[model samples]
Target: MKKQELIHLHGLLAEVCNHYEELSGATVAHEEYSELGIRPTSIHKSKTDHKAAVFALADGITNEMTEETKEPVSAAAD
Candidate 1:
């Protein structure tokens, strides 16, 4: 895929992962850096690992956001 395609795919994957994590109330863990962001090189790793890591981070952010919002989580829709 072209660079732009890859970037777009990465974003879509992240959004899906975030939605999953928000609905499931699960914590997703991945690598993080204090000063610099995730290494650009790592972003292009073998598809499996790269995708997994991206999703995991998205999940983590989603979970955190949900918790901070203080909204009650329910399995059944009201």
Candidate 2:
């Protein structure tokens, strides 16, 4: 993806993290992403930096969700 597209995706994921936290009253621990100091608006940063931030952010969000969902539902439908 182009740099602009990647940045856009990063912004969207950030929004998701924020929304999830607000709705769940829980925090998404994105320490890796925070350490990178690369916000979606950080256009000055390199594409690589934004890419890494996106991965870290996504991983954090998914990890939190996985912890919350311990039981798996059956795939069968009645």
Best model number under TM-score = 2
Q: Candidate 2, clashing residue pairs?
A: none
Candidate 1 lDDT tens digits, 4-55: 4555666675666557668868644444421224333555555554455455
Model 2 scores a TM of 0.91
Q: Could you tell me the lDDT of residue 66 within candidate 2? A: 87
Best by lDDT: 2
Residue 74 alpha-carbon offset, candidate 1, angstroms: 28
Q: What alpha-carbon RMSD in Å does predicted model 1 have with respect to the real structure?
A: 7.6
Worst 10-residue lDDT window for candidate 2 reads 66-75
TM agreement with the true structure for every prediction: 0.42, 0.91
Q: In lDDT terms, how accurate is model 2?
A: 0.95
Task: Write out the backbone clash pairs for model 1.
Answer: none
Candidate 2 per-residue lDDT, tens place, 1-78, comes to: 999999999999999999999999999989999999999999989999999999999999999998888798689997
Candidate 2: list runs displaced more than 4 Å. 73-78
**Poorest 10 consecutive residues by lDDT, candidate 1:** 31-40
